[model samples]
Target chain A: MNKIILLNNRPTGKPQASDFKFTDENKPEIAKGEILLKTKFVSVDPYLRGRMSNAESYVEPFKLNKPISSGCIAEVVESKNESFKKGDFVSGSLDWKEYQVSNGKGLLTIDASIAPLSTYLGILGMTGLTAYLGLTEIGVPKKGETIVVSGAAGAVGSVVGQIGKILGCHVVGIAGTDEKVAMLKSKFGFDDAINYNTTKDIKKAIATACPNGIDVYFDNVGGDISDNVHANINRFGRIIVCGAISAYNETSVPTGPRVEHFLIRKSVLMQGFIIGNYVEKFPEGIKQLSKWLQEGKLTYTETIVEGFDTIPQAFMDLFEGKNTGKMIVKI
Target chain B: MNKIILLNNRPTGKPQASDFKFTDENKPEIAKGEILLKTKFVSVDPYLRGRMSNAESYVEPFKLNKPISSGCIAEVVESKNESFKKGDFVSGSLDWKEYQVSNGKGLLTIDASIAPLSTYLGILGMTGLTAYLGLTEIGVPKKGETIVVSGAAGAVGSVVGQIGKILGCHVVGIAGTDEKVAMLKSKFGFDDAINYNTTKDIKKAIATACPNGIDVYFDNVGGDISDNVHANINRFGRIIVCGAISAYNETSVPTGPRVEHFLIRKSVLMQGFIIGNYVEKFPEGIKQLSKWLQEGKLTYTETIVEGFDTIPQAFMDLFEGKNTGKMIVKI
Candidate 1:
């Protein structure tokens, strides 16, 4: 018997605890080219909110009475294919349950001795890749340039700021709280950090932090913060849109910044990027990221909640800006 | 004596005739390093409206009681510098004036025999450079791909659409009137043309015209039309923001479709471009544009408004989308 959390109904706004129901299910089947995996950590990202509501999106919405799926780090218990065997750790699209099956695709094998299993769910997995590709490919940072990041304490933003620092650019991070701001400077080595909740004039705050104006902006929380950054972007600046956590939960359309003139005057390049879209380039990216980790040039932190029953709370916490780093639920 | 229009006051909204006053003044003397020239053609563009307002922009706003300046083609009558002589055709940053004396630093000598003097104000000049840079550098069109251009019958937009067709891409043009739409297909050689004013559902109209969705969008009129194009932008689409004639006269923020989400889903690249900033590479751009014209790969049209006294109305007419191609005032 395996414990699984199944979607009861499509959520309208903020998902309630009743929206997901925890139940026991029989799971022991391994068909041809399939492997049975035990969940070590179930990742909860803000994008899951989009999946909770049935809307036109990049991926299909989760159906009712089915377990929610995400990038989970799991241990291969049994295998029917040559790719994996018993005791091999893998990470890919998996269910929020004790064990599930994957048919060799979208699954990644990880070495347990190299890093902790939960690290794969946060740093070495999708979250880190989101930051890596977004910064290097989309952000296209230059040496000595300033890169501003919103939602700086979150998984992707934190990694982005750290990577910006590693790439020799001045990194300014904007978060919701004082603690997150402190974490950005102290833990991530960002040049400057701003608590947006405390700042009255965000544009002034960004200008004060970045005297020369922003060169690259990795937008994770796009609302007024994006507008503030848009106002101060330098000529030929690059803006990378990774996510918009601020607007994802809204039941209605939020008033965003009127930015057309700013784009024209500055000739800024604003590009959006998703990590999954770069699957073919994953091996090269992962190899470089692994080397950066081994060289101590890169570091990551994950906030873990124990038990599968805490998945709903873990996901809910993402919207409230509760977690400091990548929010992961250890099963 | 020379006739010139001086900026009497800053415009509150769409500029009227009262905002400028025509006056006769003594012809400016040629200084030690200056040249005296007679204005031949003056460019009346949408960007001039932005220059009239006292706002912080990429270019310095026009001062009150000063004649508004724009790109103009002139004939040199007197020269104190050795580089220029009488009867030489020159293009430079002059004002809405009949005759002016200027330093030779910013002026470029031109051969009117190669192309018409008005062509220097339109296809062979700033409008051409704007379209070239906006499409090649910003839009980055791929061969066999589809490109959609807004304000398609206007100066920059028409050239951009024609360049798209020349690049072997199917070009869809969106203009204001049915006549303009017909002209876009017939004169500009566009694959399809849409009169956005007549189209009930712009998204559906664009979808019907471009079954593959717009891969490269050269946006000139930025409002609901831009929003409609953005909603249907293909994955990895590039949008080049050359001008926003629709929003130039707007006193308050324009209300339309929200775009922060589009940045996330499509990984779209929206950039603004100005020709002056690319001065370092302008010669190269001009050479290519000139070669295209000489080879008959490029065709150009001009909406010539005769008389120096008609400059104010020529400029005002741009706000109403009155011009078919490049709006030039023949002095």
Candidate 2:
């Protein structure tokens, strides 16, 4: 029997584990030109929260009563496809099920020896590519310039700050807790990290942290935090709008101080992009990320929950600021 | 005697003529390498309002009890400089007075035969260059794409829409009156025009006009109108923030709907810039603007208020949307 999680209902303000229902069914079978995959590691991302709503977005909404899907690291249990042999590790967009059958079209056979299989679901995968492209293409961080990133303890923001440091920038991070702030400074080598939850005046805290003013801002959490960052951007600054995890669960569109005046005064540039736009550059991104990993210049951390039943809870924990870094479920 | 306008007091909300005081002083003498200029036309621009406030900005504030300065087209009455001659027409930053002295360091000699002297204050001078660079470098309007210009009947915006038409784009203009709206479509050749003052729902009107969505937004008026445009921007859209006339007079920063979420979902690029940023490219801008003028592809209009004493009133009229195009003072 196979266990799967289904989106039973849409979320209101904050998502709950009860929103998803677990059910058991027969394991999917493999046919000609297909391979049967046993789930190994499943990624729980902030962007998935956007898919739970019916609003128009970069990706389609997850339908009710349908199996929820995300990036999954799986092992081939049986194979009829010549390309994917049994016992091989691969990654692809797969269902939250114990077993899945794929035609091997979108699957990429990953080498676990190069790095852990879970790393392919994170630092060497979509999150890493998002950081690389957003920072280089949009943020365009220069040496000696200051780069500030919000949600600094999360999966994408952690990678973004590391890349900023690698590019010779003064990196400042904003996270929710002192523990996360300490990890950012000690583990990630961020020049300074602010605890947004403890700080009363975010604007003043950011001003103190970034004395030279911000040149590039990687925004993962948007709201008053972004408003404060905008107030201090230098001339010709670049803002990379990666996500708005702060407002993703709101039933209505969120409102904050308008940014046009600030943007015009400083002659700044702000851009928003999704990782799918750089699909053609994935191989290059993977190569560079892997090289950095091998050089010991980049390190990653993950919070793993040890069962498929915890998938819903792990995803909800992202909003609660309960996870230190990338949150994944080991099935 | 030299007559000049002085800023008596800062405005609280909307500027009135009482904020300025007309005074007379001794006539200045020209020194070596200097030329005595007889002011012919003085420009009253929306950006001048920003200079009236004692705030950090691209340009310095107008000091109280001192003569305000603006772009002036003048005739050289006496030339002690080798670069300028008697009776030569020139344009440069000068005090708001009938007679003034210059060193000719930042002055550009103009030929009135090529274009009117006041055209140097409008279409062939800083205003023209502003429209050109903001549209091309930032807006980046592509053929068949829809380009929307707010404050569409004003000096900078009129030129922006006309340039959009020349670039083979479906140009849409947003103005405050029906007459300006008609002028935009008939005289400026905009494909469509919206009267933001009369429209009940600007977002719906823009949606109906631009079924394909806005590809480029040339913003001059920033407030509620900009909020509506942001809601309808297409994927990969470019928003050029040239001026924020709507908020220049407010005592405090204005609030509106947040754009970070909208920007992130569509992968849009929004940038703010001053014309001074493109100073190195002025020669290119002038050459292109001149070519367009000679080709009869671009035309300009001005509301020339007679007498220098009306300069204060002319500047105030901008906020009230009293002038259709460039507002200037004929001295």
Candidate 3:
């Protein structure tokens, strides 16, 4: 028997566990040129929350009563494909189930000796590529310039701040908790970190952190936090709009301060892009990220929730900012 | 004797005639390597409003009780420099006075036979350079793309729309009056024109006009009109923030719909710039503009207010959308 989870309901605000349903189904059969994979780990990212709603987005919305899916690390138990073989570890988009059938089309074989299998879904995977591409391509941080990152404790933002430091920039991060702030400074080497949740005036806090003003802004949390950051941006600044996790779960369209005057006055540039836009440069990005990791210039952390039943809870935790880094469900 | 206009008081909202005071002063004398210039035509632009305030901006604010200065076309009455001779027509920044003393360093001799002297204050000058640089650099319009321009009847916006047409793009113009809208379509060769003043729903109007969606936006009006234009932008849209005439007179900071999520979802790029930033590329811009003028591909209009006393009134008319194109004060 194969157990899978389906999206049962659309969430209005914060998602509830009841929005997902767990059920059992017959194991899928792998035909010729196909591989049968046993699930090892499932990635629960903030972007998944956007798929839960029936709204037009970069990706299609998740259909009701359909198996919810995301990035997953799996082991091939059986393979009819010459590209993959039994006992080989692979990574691909897969449903939240114990077993799945794949044609090995989008699946990539993973080398366990490079790093842990779960990290392939995180630091060495889409998360790392997102941070590297968005920061370098859009933000374009220069040496001695101040780089500010919002949602600093999250998977992508943590890497962005670390890369900013590596490029000889003064990095400042805004996270939700004091613990996350401490992690950003102590572990990630962020020059300064502010706990946005406890700060009375975010604008003042940002001003204090960035004495010379923000030259590059890697925005993961949009809303008031972004407004504050925009207010403190330097002349010829760059703002890379990565994600707006703060407004993702809102029932209505979110609104905040307009930035036209700010941008015009400062001669700033604000660009919004997804990692997929840089697909042609992924090999370059992965090569650099891997090199940095090997040289011990980069580090990452993960919050692993064991058991297939914890997938929904782990995903919902993203909206609550409960995970310090990449959130994963280990089966 | 030299008659000049000085700033009587800083304006809180919309400026008034009383904000300027006319005074008489002794004629300035030209020293060695300098020229004594008799003012001919003064350029009254919307950007001047930003300099009237005590706020920090790209250019320093005008000092209290000092003569207001702007781009002016003048005749060299006496020359002490080898580069300039008496009776030569030149353009440069000059105080709002009948006569000015210049070091001939920043002055550029203009050939009146090439274009009208007043046009040197408009089409062949800063206004034309603004349109060329902002459109080509930031807007980056492609052939077959749809370009929407706000304040389309104004100096910079008019040129931007015409350039879009020359680039084989579908051009749409948004103006404040029906007459201006008609001029944009009939005279300026814009493919479509909308009267934003009479439109009930700007968003729906933009959607109707730009059926294919806006690929590039040359924004001069930055309030609800811009918010509507931003909503109708296509994927990978580009917004060139040139000016914010709509908010220039607002007593408090203006607020409108936020665009971070919109930019993120569509992978849009928004950039703000002043023409001065492209000083190094002026020769390139002027060559293109001069070629278009000579080829009869570009035409410009100006509303000339005779007499030096009318300078303040002409400037105030910009905020009211009373000028069709460049507003000039002939002194």
Q: For candidate 1 chain B, which ten residues in a row score worst on lDDT? A: B252-261
Clashes of 1: 0
For candidate 1, write residues A45-77 as lDDT tens digits: 988888887776677899899989988888888
Off by more than 4 A, model 1: B31-33, B295-297
Q: Write the per-residue lDDT of candidate 2 for residues B146-221, one digit (tens) a residue.
A: 9999999999999999999999999899999999999999998999999998999999999988999999999998
- Give the TM-scores of the predictions, in the order they appear: 0.95, 0.98, 0.98
Give Cα-based local distance difference scores for all models: 0.86, 0.91, 0.91
Q: Quote the lDDT for A186 in model 2.
A: 97
Kindly indicate the candidate among 1 and 2 with the higher DockQ.
Answer: 2
Compared with the real two-chain complex, what DockQ does model 3 have?
0.78
lDDT of 2 by residue, A104-156 (tens): 98899999889988999889988889999889989988899999999999998
Q: Stretches of candidate 2 above 4 Å error?
A: none
Q: Which candidate has the top score in DockQ?
A: 2
- Give Cα distance to truth, residue A230, candidate 1, Å: 1.8
